[model samples]
Target: MTGLSAAAGLGRTSALAVACARDLARHAAEHPGLFPARPFDAGFFHSLGLVGAFGSPWATAGELRAVNRAALWVFAVDLQVDHVAKSREEVAALVGDCLAVAAGDAPRGPLTQCLASLRDDLGADPRWRDQLERMLAAMLKEWDWRESGATPGLEEYLRNADSCGSAFVNLSHWLATGDQWTLANLDLVRAADDEVQRYLRLLNDLTTYDREARWGDANALTLGAGRAEVTERMARHARTAAELIDPLRETSPRTALYLERQVGFNTGFYGVSDYWGEL
Candidate 1:
C-alpha cells in the first residue's frame, strides 16, 4: 500500500477506537460497581477500544460492540473473583449469578446485569453461553487453586486458559459480526481461538508476574515455570494457532484475519503496556 493509504488506514482505526471508547465508557458508567475507577480508568477504556478496533480494523464501532463489551465483562469478572470476593462462597455466588443471567434469569446485580445486556445483544448463540461457562469455570478453578495454595502443573495451568477470556471475546465477536461461513465453521475457528488464548495466557503471565505476585493471583511463573519455559510454550501454541487458522482463510477469511491480528497486536502491545490501570 502507498504511504497515503497506510496513513488513511491508521486514521480510520483511530477514529473507530475513539468511538469504541465512548461506547465502553457509557457501559462502564451504567455499571459503576463492576468497573471501579482505580483499575478501569480512562486508559483501560482507550486500550480496550484499540484492541477491538485494531483486531478487526474492517469493523465499525457498532460491529465491534459485542467483542468490546465481552472484553470489558471479562475484566469485571476478574476484578470480582480476584479482588472483591472475600470468601469462596462469595465467589461461588458471583459465578452462580452470572450463569443464571446467561441462562435467561433476571440479573441480580451489576455484574449479572452487564452480562445479561451482553447476552441479549448477541442474539441467540448457544456457543456464547458455552464459552462463557468455560471462562467462569476456569476462573473458579484458579480461585480454588489460590485459596488452597495449590501449584498446578504447567500443562494444567495452560489447559485452564479460558480464564484468559480471549476465546470468549472472540466468540462474541464472531457471533456479532461474522459472515455465514464464519458462523458455520465456529467450531474450527474456536479450536484456533483456544490455542491463541493459551498463548495469550502465557504472554500475560510473562509480563504481569510481579503484579500477579503482589495481588496474590495465580500465574504460570508463580507456579514455578521459568520465563524460558513460558516463552517456549507461547511459541509452541502460537505455531499451533497458526496451523489451525490457516485452513479458515479460504472459507472464513475475516475470521482468520481477526485471529491473526489478535496474536500480532498483543505480541507488540503487551511488550510495552497492558490494558489495566494502576491498582
Candidate 2:
C-alpha cells in the first residue's frame, strides 16, 4: 500500500476513536451526578465495541485487547471525574496507565496485536503515529491537573478535548490527500452519514425523559439541544470522512470489514435504549 493508503486506514480508526470520545463526553455531561455514584460498569464488551469500531478485526487480537484495556482506563477517568474526586496520585496512575498502553510499552495482548498489525500495514507512515503520540501527550498533560483534584484551565481542557477530535481529523486529512485511497472504495462517507442519523435518533430517545419530567425541563432544554448540535457536527465530519474512505474500501477489504463491524458495535452497545431502557 502507498503511504496515503496506510494513512487512510489510520484515519478511519481515528474517526471511530473520536466518536467514542464524543459519546463518553456526552454521557458524562448528561449524567454527571449518576456516573460518580454508580461507577460506570457498562461492561468490558460494551467498551470493546467502541474499540472494535475504530480499530479493525484484522488487527491481531492483542491489539484489540490493548485497545479495550486502554479504553477502560480512559472511560474510568471520565466516570470517576465527579465521583471519587481523585487525588493527584490516583489521577497520575490513570494517566500513566493510558500512556503506557498507547505507547506500546504495556504488555502485548489481543488489542496490542491488532495495533501492531495496523502499524505494520502503515509502514513508514509517520503521520498516524505522530498524531497518536500528540494525542497521548495532550492527555497526559491534562491528567497532570486532574491529579490535583483541580480541573485543567478551560483552554487546556479544551485543547485536550480537541485531541480527541483531531484523532479523526488526521484520518480524514490522510484520506483526502492520499493517492491510493479514495472515497469510492472506503464507503467511509456513507458509513459516517449512517452514524450521524443513528446518533440523532439515539440522543432523542435517550433524553425523552428529561423532556417530560417535572425537573427535567432544564436538562431537556439545554442538554437535549446541545446534543442535537453535537450530533449535527459529527454528521458533517462523518460525511467528510466518508468522502475520504469510500474510495479506498474496495482496495482494503479487511479495513472495510473492520469499519462495518465497528458501526454495528457502536449501535448495538451504546445505543441509548440499551443503557436507558427504564428511562
Q: Of the candidates shown, which would achieve the greatest TM-score relative to the real structure? A: 1
Candidate 2: residue 109 lDDT (0-100): 39
* Highest lDDT model number: 1
- Name the TM-score of candidate 2: 0.42
230: Cα error in model 2, Å:
2.0
> Which residue pairs of candidate 1 clash?
none
User: How many clashes (backbone atoms < 3 Å, residues ≥3 apart in a chain or on different chains) does model 1 have?
Assistant: 0
Q: Estimate each model's TM-score.
A: 0.98, 0.42
Q: Residue 175, candidate 1: how far off, in angstroms?
A: 0.7
> What 10-residue stretch in candidate 2 is worst by lDDT?
215-224
Off by over 4 Å in 2: 1-64, 77-225, 273-279
**Tens digit of per-residue lDDT, candidate 1, span 156-259:** 99989999899999999888898998888788989999999999999999998888899888899999999999999999999999999999999988889989
